[model samples]
Target chain A: MQKSTQAGFWKKNQRALAPWFFMAPGIIMFLVYVIYPIFQSIGISFYEWDGLGPKTYVGLQNYRDLLDDDSFYTSLKNNVIWLVLYLLAIPAGLAVALFLNQTVAGIRLYKSLFFFPFVISQVVVGLIFTWFYAPGFGILPHVINFFTGTPTAILADDKYATYGVIAAGLWPQTAYCMILYLTGLNNISPDQVEAARMDNAKGWSMLWHIIIPQLRPATFIALVVTVIGALRSFDLISVMTVGGPFGSTRVLSYFMYEQSLSEYGTAMGYGAAIAVVLFAIMLVFISLFIVRMLSQERNA
Target chain B: MFPKPIAQSGPWTQRAYKTLLPIALVLWLLPLIGIAITSIRPGSDLASGNYFGMPSGFAGWENYSSVFKNSNIGYYILNSFRVTIPTVIGAVGLSCLTGYALAVYKFKGNLAVFFMFVAGNFVPFQILAIPVRDLTLHMGLYNTMTGLVLFHIAFQTGFCTLFMRNFMKALPFALIESARVEGVSEFRIFWHIILPLVRPAMAALAVLIFTFIWNDYFWATVMAQSVDVRPVTAGMNELKGQYKVAWELISAAAIVAALPPVAMFFLMQKHFIAGLTLGATKG
Candidate 1:
């Protein structure tokens, strides 16, 4: 009698319970670790509290201070610069991928070598570029010296420090974009390409019309990743400049790190505010990604 | 196909393309090449202004030995493994279950749960920084390897679940339906029928997560305070502080820090690319 009861209950509730049983641990961990924290961080943005001290409510004061603070503006402007300039990686990556898409000998090894930068840790990439741009022993200085009369101190100069860091970042980002494009190129419909060729679509016309239109998926992914990479660019700035040279290289992410996490002092509220702004910026892209994913899911 | 294969071009054009390939690659990897060379160059070579020239002596052994001897890099590397291995297992293992649930079950709010993981996976880490740190501290896991590993596992599950669910969804649902009709238990259906089929997806996610957790720097610094718990990426910063002017030693250490992932990338090239290009082809 108990066996029949157990079987009946199992048959009735199995589907409902089974999914939760599988999803429970993952959802619970994600909620605790990722989702709840987003709201908590947003809530903390309104108050004035150091990491250690008593939490006092100071309603929008942190955001207010952010406007008057010069370093905050510097970080904001630099973030804007990062976002605008980092888009270059996509086209740069596409160009390289196109150049190497041929059936040349030893091309596989060449492709891997080009893609090596992305595989390594960013710390190593930052260190490599830092030495590459150093004034005395850095190799890029020689190129600058050849072009101009003197080899300028690139990282220490306010005019070019962010650009230098961006260049360092592009090294890996372009490689990533290249790999994506390579795979995309591999899967492009040969019939379409041949069809376009018959219509006299050669060179630029071919790529612009036939090739690029088909590469929309790769382009979208590349753009999304590049934007996120630009905004979340903490490691490179931390390693290369540490927001040095009169705080010229501080993006929103690094700026928040300096304010709250560094040895300088913890302005927990202010840091949270900065993080909220960064989160808000990322939300635009995140929503776009979700909409795309949702549509894809519906189609599936 | 768009560019028109070089073989179809004039012989002159094809020859030029061949010549330019090596030159372009060399120039592209110039900075890495410089460091790779410097990692082995004797200190005397740098002092004598042999930056670009050939090293006077191959001090590769000496520089690498001293990096291991004079620093806690070995410890940092061990810490990295501790964090990476567990995070991979946890994230991938949990993701398999979640992915299977989402893929197989015809339950309500299935898409909602799956989409939450997708959205959360892309969020900037700065937002999560304070609260996660606080939670870790509250749970008495702060500044410990377990703290970093647990957070990595949790956070990585967001992405891994998305990947795994999509992978599982591609499998033929007919198999699951047949098994259900045969009166096999749901758990056994998952274990015997589905688990073996998702092995490729599991391997791909494992290698991808390994590289990610291993290469992580932001969380390492935020969560780990001391060298004992610090991963190599963050510890290399401290090594930079210690080896202020020792470029060769620093370069060697940097190379050492980069090896495992580079080696992994080469060894698991197929799975790594499959994992990374997960959503690039479709939506």
Candidate 2:
């Protein structure tokens, strides 16, 4: 009798219970690793602690210190520079995609080769650029020297260091956006293009009115990723300059890592504070993307 | 079609376009081409200030072998595979379940749950880094490959779930309804029906995650310390420091470190692009 009753309960509840069961492991893992850590980091920011020490409550002192620190402002300014310059990848990517959109022999190989930088690790990209800008032996510096009668080591100078890293970063980022646009182009309605052509639309006007509108979805994604990439610009900085040349290349992400983990110091609370600020900035973008995706889901 | 299909243009225009394509590609890949050449150039060529000149002789074997002989790079790359493969399987496997639940079920808070994953996917690693490190240390998993793998799997599930959920959503809902009418259990329906259909997505997710985790540097540095567990990206930095002046060897090591993902991209070009351009069209 009890066995039958238990079976009845199972049969009745299984439909409802099934989804939760499927979702449980993923949710729990995400909560543990990704979600909960967010709040914990926020909590840690309010306390003073070296990585190895006991915590003491110190409300807003880190943020207060940030206000007075020049490095903080420098990092913030560089992040703004990164965000603005990174969006150039979208238009640049579209240009490359258009250039390679032709149906020539071996164009498939050429397209993939053009997308090669994005496939390789950024660490490798950074190293490649490092070798390219290594002063006397580096190619770019030599070219500049030929033009100006003085070799300029771009990564070593304060004014050009951030720009140099951004340029290296743009190589892979532009490739990423190019692939996105390529896929978008492949999916575009050929009839629409033919119609536009029949109307004598050619050159910049056709691209502006027809092709650009069609690539909206690709452009949206390109913007999201490029923005995120700019804000998360750590690997290139870490690999290329290690936030050096008088700390001119420091961004918020690298600054946080340097504060908490590097040999210079291990101020965990301060690092958490920096991370919280970064998170707050990212949250704004995250919310915007999520809302857009939510609307798309509803329409779908 | 947009550019009026070069075949319709004059022969001179077509010839100009054909000539321009290779030139543009060459210029675009100049840095990488430089690195590849430097990797194979004889050390004496560099020493003799012949950096840009044609190579004196092929030293690819010597430079690549010396990188292996002089450092723990081989072990580091092995550790990378150890961390990356398991992450791909775990993240993709777990997401297959979560994605199905969210996509097929009309439960309350489904949108909220889905958005949570999406938002979590985009947050900066810095926010999670300190606490995740703390958690790993407390669990005595720090400096272990398992620690890195576990964290990667958990974190990647966010992105994987977003991908899988969207993919599964595009499937025919009638299949599930018909199965329900036949009294098929939900688990069996997912296993016997949905799983087979999503193989393309699984392939796509697998290659993408493999590359992401393989190329990962931040977590490798934060979570693993000892050379035994450090993956190649972090190890590449260490190798760079060790090989400060050996541009040839450093270039070789960088190429070796980047080889697997590049090979994977070429091998799985179709699914890789499909995965990357997931929401770049239609929605």
Tens-place lDDT per residue, model 1, A91-169, is: 9999999999999889988998899999999999999998999887889998899999799888999999999999999
Q: Residue A26 lDDT in model 2?
A: 99
Which regions of candidate 2 deviate over 4 angstroms? none
User: Can you give the lDDT of residue B282 in candidate 2?
Assistant: 79
lDDT of 1 at A207: 87
Compared with the real two-chain complex, what DockQ does model 2 have? 0.86
Q: After superposition, how far is residue A171 of candidate 2 from its true place, in Å?
A: 0.3
lDDT of 2: 0.93
TM-score of chain B of each: 0.98, 0.99
Which candidate gets the maximum DockQ versus the true structure?
2
Tens digits of per-residue lDDT for model 2, A153-177: 9999999999999999999999999
Interface RMSD of 1: 1.0
| Cα-based RMSD of candidate 1 | 1.1
